[model samples]
Target: MPQLAEKVPPSVAGAVLRAVFALPDPVRRLIAGRAVVRDGQRLALDAQLLLLMTRLEGASLTGATVPEARQGLARGQRYINRLPERPVRTRDLAAADGIPARLYEPKGLAEGSPLLVFFHGGGWVIGDIESHDSVCRYLAVNAEVRVLSVDYRLAPEHRFPAAADDALAAYAWAVENAAALGASPEAVAVGGDSAGGNLAAVVGAFADRRPDFALLFYPATDMSVRRRSRELFADGFYLTDADMVWFSDHYCPDVERRTDPKASPLLADDLSGFPATYLVTAGFDPLRDEGEAFGERLREAGVRVAVRRQEDLIHGFANMWGLGGRFQEALAEAAGALRTGLL
Candidate 1:
């Protein structure tokens, strides 16, 4: 590990710390107070937990059914609707196998504009193009690039390989129809957060030709539930252990499929021939160690890799960019990485 810095800039570090601490005590208490119980024994996720989760994530759940999960995801979409509008031209493009995407093209683009196909994060269960609109908007406006935000199918309703297939299809479409979108086929990149990031990595690994760069934000690289970090930072860190368990159960009900490389990229035996990678990790996130470890593996495989650890930040900080003060700093860092990698 690199030598630790004594202190980081307060504007970034302090703000993140305050945000994590400012979460409702009841929610924190629930996470901290949780205990492992036998499987199939019902645990009440009552109104209090639901309300707390709703407040924190802008998701709502009346019950644990798939329909309720979709409703909760819609609530998150509504919450992200507050960002200021920028000039972006929207289009419905046909991707691989007729999988469609809502592409956002920033105004005032020259020919051969760089393109970024973004996948939204929601543990592959919740979230869509609408849920991640703000993030795509920010990237398109600030980075001055065209962004193709995909609405890939979610899990439990559409499981493992389905999402990966959609991601690959999207990439193929971007490559074939780059000119129609006013982008350079060669300059196109792939990126996302959480489950989306996992998809991005998987697609990069499997694409017949790789993207120019890969951007991963707090990606869940490993699906194994046994990591030490999973146990250590599993609570009071925004993305709780219970929440991950719920997401995993919904994503992969069949335990045997957890080892599938498409489901868990960290378990893949080979890491060669993928695009150069920029991986960002939140220090307090349960997925942090695995993301960092994946970056290391990429470097070991002779792929160019840059890893940034936002030590004071928690999981899902990217989605909180519009609301959190420290988000600009993080975004700036990400933009810098993209510029270096893409240019």
Candidate 2:
């Protein structure tokens, strides 16, 4: 990858996608029609927009140049940037270990609002704080809590424990620095989508004060084994089994290491004291089975758990609230649960 490859601003990718978005609906449906979720459930109108993003993000790049993947990811970042903006005061900061993070404060939050430290999903490879900005803003306003979006290191460049380490460090930073940030240690929560969700689950097992609750949206819990969802939703969906393999390969690389408790929280022998969790799963996501499996494990361990399965939604729907049917419903369910638990 050339140094100039990094210089290709995300805005260019955004513009290209904006043009694609501006095209007639018939054209979009044609180019992206193949992005069908194999489960027989049609992608709703709003959910269909996510396929356009999937197309823009460029699939089939496992063995390709890093620049190609970067370019593809940039388009998704732009797609996130294009989501509706809501009222939230934001600031850029760093975690305790100096990992970059963005803080979003919803306007008119009650004094001493609860705080949520969030991690974005991209299989620990592509997504950044920018990619999940809209979801964070929506959470902040709707849940009435401030959110710290951690921009942890990615794979191929930084692998395995780097992301896990940063996630723990970010959560620690929030709890330790809660007072100054207008949140309390008791009210602090950690959550994420996909890879971020996996990190949240891992961090909950070791957090100092322990997170009060967890919000995991279709997290990849047991990468060591192939499950039913993977076989069932392997192709056509926004997130495919091949994509999961690509992600796990880049992030963990070492097959044996994928079973590490930190990498695969579901493999943990003891989860007795883990925080209450709201585990979300999209019916069409390849990782759905594992996410649910983790939830069942939590229940077996006596940890309170709420599982919401969005049957008609696909992977990445949590990040696509603009497609406001089941996607928004899922988001609302999680936010409402968090408000009840944290506030």
Candidate 3:
């Protein structure tokens, strides 16, 4: 067990919010009903609640210009990470590929400890190291492993394979310079969430010195092929199909390139002998089906794969642990998986 891990507190504020947001259908309908529901599945209560909060805070990005969207997301991310954090030691570095990154080391980690090189999720476009700081800190502390969060180049500004290439390079760098950061080269793992998760899977395919394990959270395994989740949870949820389409267009301008194995690991011809892997998906996430598909393919290819579906969550639950409730518990479970897989 990790020596010093923290969980988001379920205070009075959270209780009030849930009690209000999780109100009866008739009451919700009178408030913001049909606007955020689909097929009467009721959407995840936490997700719908957050959407209502975001809408109130002016967080819609649909049809927003690139600059406007980036700024808006960055602002919200900054606010979320603004709360005081746990006492994990952190530092910044530039990968050999010149991509920026942040490293988080739990106060209790000994020399030559396990390391997870992580990539942040934003559909290959709008996330940064700062945005994912809380998640990294939580993982580093709870998993009892150091986390190196890579700030890969985003879409439109830097297109297809740019983020992929950077993720790979960061993984390589983490392996090469492990001892310098008090980590073990042989214990390094590659992981990410969403676009970052996609990048992690891409890196997982490399025949060259591969990481000991791979961890992906709701990754977009198939960029070119649309799965059932794409149609199923296309709207009202946190990550909409329209946003996916926009992200794909910006990241891979050429439709053909999106099918390339490097861009979509799910389309890879073979995935045999890949390292031990852990994949997580959210039931209500638009990318849920694709994430599970990747894990299933890897298992079928004879690789050791472990998959977990957060059946009551949304697209970005892995990164929202700080929001409290079940999200924090889910993240803690994921960290336990990370430790078990790596150690």
lDDT (tens digit, per residue) of candidate 2 on 1-343? 4333245566775565557656777787776675454456656544566555655444442336555665565555454453435579999987787899998887777667899999999888887887788889888888889899999999979999999999998899899888778776679999999999999999988766789989999998997999988898887668878778888888888998989989999999999889988998988788999999999999999999998888778787767664455577888888999888885
Q: What stretches of model 2 exceed 4 Å from their correct place?
A: 1-45, 48-63, 80-86
What lDDT is reached at residue 60 by model 3? Answer: 47
TM-scores for every predicted model: 0.80, 0.86, 0.87
Model 1 segments more than 4 A misplaced:
1-63, 80-86
- Best candidate, lDDT-wise? 2
lDDT of 3 by residue, 49-111 (tens): 666765554454334678766765665554344232557998998976788888898876799
lDDT per residue (tens digit) for residues 1-343 in model 1: 2111113332443344345435776764565356322222222222123224434433332226766666555554454343545687788766778776878777776778888989888888888887788788778777777889888888887887788889988888888888888898889999999889999998877888789999999888878756666776776555777777877888887888888888888778888887898999876678888889889889988899899987656677777666444555686688678767888
For residue 29, give model 3's deviation from the true position in Å.
12
- Using lDDT as the yardstick, the better of models 1 and 2 is 2
Shift in Å, residue 315, candidate 3:
0.5
Worst lDDT run of 10 residues, candidate 1, spans 38-47
Off by over 4 Å in 3: 1-43, 61-63, 82-86
Q: Which residue pairs in candidate 3 have backbone atoms (N, alpha carbon, C) closer than 3 angstroms, thus clashing?
A: none
Per-model root-mean-square deviation over C-alphas: 10.4, 3.9, 6.9
Top candidate, metric TM-score = 3
Error of 1 at 214 (Å): 0.1
